[model samples]
Target chain A: MESNRTESRENRYLNPYLGGVLLGLVVIAAFYTSGRGPGATGALKGLIVTGVEAVVPEAAASSGFVAEYREPLPGHPLRSWLVFQMMGLITGGFLSGAFAGRLKFRIEHNYRITSERRLLMALGGGILFGFGSQLGRGCTSGAALSGMSVLSLGGFITMVSIFGTAFALAWFFRKNWI
Target chain B: MGPLVIYEVISENINLLTAFIIGTAFGWVLESSGFSSSRKLAGVFYGYDMVVLKVFFTAAVTGMLGLLFMSLFGWIDLSLVYVNPTFLTSAIAGGVVMGAGFIMGGFCPGTSFSAAAIGKIDAMVFIVGLFIGIGLFGAGYSIWQELYLAADMGHLKISDSLGMSDGLFALLLILAASAIFYFAEMVERKFASHRL
Candidate 1:
C-alpha cells in the first residue's frame, strides 16, 4: 500500500494552468534579460556546428550554414548563449526529476510497440523536426511559443501549420501512441 | 531600461548566466507539468489529455499579456526584443513537416531535452537523430536555399497584418483561448475512458 501510494503520488504532475503561468514568467524573464527568447534547437545547432568545425575545418568554413554559426577568432560556438541555456535545461530537468523521485533510466512506450520500434520512430521524427526547424527558422518553442507572444505573423503561421498538420496526421500514427 | 543586456546594463557573461537561470526554470516547469512524458504529450492529439494545449496556449497568452503590460509601464523596450521574421513558404512547409514529426516522435526539441535528462532512452535517441537531421540539412543547404529564403516577409506582427490594435487582438485571443480550453476539457473527458 505504501509503495502504491508513492507511485500514484509520483505520477501526479502540476496543474496545467499553473505550469503555463510559470513557463510564461520564465519566457518573460528571458526576453527581459537577454532581449531574446529561449530556444532548444539553436543550442543543438551550435553543437552540430562545433562538431563540424572540429572534425572538418575546411567543410565548416565553406558551408554557409555552418559559417553563419562560426564565431570570431577568439569566440567559439560552444560558448553561445543557447548552448549554455541548453546545459541549464538539462541540469534543471535533472534536478526536477530528482526532487520528484522520477529519475529512472528506461524506455517509455505503449504496449502496442517494441522499444526498438519506438526508438526508430523517434529518430525519424527528430530528423523531420530538425530539418523543419531549420526551414521554419525555429522550432515550436522558438517560433510558435516565443513568436506568438510577440504577435509575429510568421509565428502564427508556423504555429497553426504545425498543430494543424499534427492533428491531421495523428490518426495515422495513433497505433504507436494510443 | 529593459533588456538590460542590450542596453549595456549587464555584461555579456551576466546575460549568458541569465539564460542558464531562465532555462533552468523553463525545464523545471516543463518537466513538472508532465512534458517529459511522450505519452502525455501525444495525448494532446488523441484527446485523452489536453495538458499540452492548455499549458502551451496559457503560457503564450501569459507571455503576450506580460510583455504588453511591461511595454505599457515602460519596463521593457519592445523595439529591442527579437521578433521572429516570417518566411511564408518555409513557415508553412516547415510547419507541416514538424507537425508530422510531433505526431511521430511524441516530443519537441525542448521537451525531448527535459525527457532525456530524466533518463528516457527514447528521448536521448531522439536527440541523436536531431543532430544527424541538422547535419543533413547543412549538407543539403544549397538545394533548399531558395525554398528557405522564398517569400521574404519582414518581421510582421499578426495584429498589424489583421489591421487590429494589439490590445484588441489580445482580448480576442483570450476569448478564443477560453473557448479552446472549454472544448479541450470536453474532449479530454470524452476520451478519458479510452486512455491507456
Candidate 2:
C-alpha cells in the first residue's frame, strides 16, 4: 500500500490482517532467501556489549554476558549481520514515519498521566522487558512469533507464557494503557 | 539441500546484506501498521484495541502456513531451519516477566525500536531500560547461570512434541489465530475506550 493511501479511522492503521500478511511474507522471504528469521533484541544486546567491550576490554572479558563477545576466536561481536539488519529496521521505520508524516518528537502516554511520568514508567517497563528478554532468550519478535512461524517449541511456549502473563496482569496495569 | 546460505549458495557477506534488507522490510511493515505506538500495541491486554491481536495472529498464521507450504514444496529445507533451544524453566519464567513488562511498557523490543525511530521518547527510554536490564543480567549472569543453562531440550519443533505433521500443526495454529482475530474484534468493541 502507498504511504499516502492508508486512511485513518479511529486513529487509522493498516488493516491488521493485511499487515499480518505482509509481515508473514517478510518472514517467508527471510527464511527462503536467507535461511534465518528476523530478530530485534539480539542486535541491541550485541550493540550494548560491543560498546562496553570497546572502552573496557577487561570488564567485557570478565563479564558473563559480555563473555558471549568472545571477539578473538568467534569474531568481532558487533560485526554480526543482525546488527546491520537492526540498523535497517531503524532506518526503515524513520522512512515510513517521514513518508506518513507521523514522525515527531514526543512521549506517547495515557491522558491521565504526564509525559514525564509516562517516560519514567516507560523506562522502568523497559528495564523489566530488557531483563525478561534475556531470560526468555529473545523478545516477542525473536522467540515467540517468529519462532512459532517455524513451529519451534520454544517459540510457542514463550509466546503463550508472555501473552498469558499479560492477560493475567492486564488489570493491574490498566492505568497505563487503558 | 536448502537453506541457501547453509548449503553454501550464498556467501556470508550476502547473508548480512539479506539480513538488512529483510530487517528493513520488517520495520516498514511494523511501523506502517501502527505497531510502533504503545497505546495501540498494548491494546491486546485491554479490550479496546485489537490491532496487536489481528496483526500478530494473522502474521503468525501466514508465516506458519507459508513455511509449511514452502517445506512441502521443497523451497526450503524444513529440518535446516533454526529452532531456539528449549530451556523449559527460563523460557516460561522469562516469558512471564516479559508479559508484565509488556503490560507496563506497552512495547516489545521490536515495536519499541519502531516507535523510537519516529521519535517516541517513551520508546527511547524503554530502550535505555533494556540496556540497563541486559547489562544487569550480564553482570549477574552467574546467579542465573545454573537455571539459565539447565534445560537440554535441543531445538525441537512443536510438531514433534505432539507427534503431528507440520502442516497439521500449522493448520491448527491458523484456526486458533482466526479465532483470536474474531474474538479480538469483539473484545475491542466491548471495551472500546477513548484513551487512544
Candidate with maximal TM-score: 1
lDDT of 1 by residue, A1-178 (tens): 9999878867889999999999899889988988888888999888888788899999888897986666332387878778778888898888898888889998999999999999999999999999989888899999999999999899999999999999999989999987
Error of 1 at A46 (Å): 0.5
Q: What is the lDDT of residue A23 in candidate 2?
A: 89
Please write out the lDDT profile of model 1 over residues B1-196, one tens digit for every residue.
Answer: 7888989999999988888998899899999999999999999999998999999999999999999999999999999999999999999999998899899999999999999999999999888888887888899999998998899889999999899999999999999999999999999999988664
Look at candidate 1 and give me any clashing residue pairs: none
Model 2, runs deviating above 4 Å? A1-10, A69-73, B193-195
> Best-fitting candidate, measured by lDDT?
1
Task: State the weakest 10-residue window (summed lDDT) of model 2 chain B.
Answer: B187-196
Clashing pairs in 2: none
**Per-candidate chain B TM:** 0.98, 0.95
Off by over 4 Å in 1: A71-74
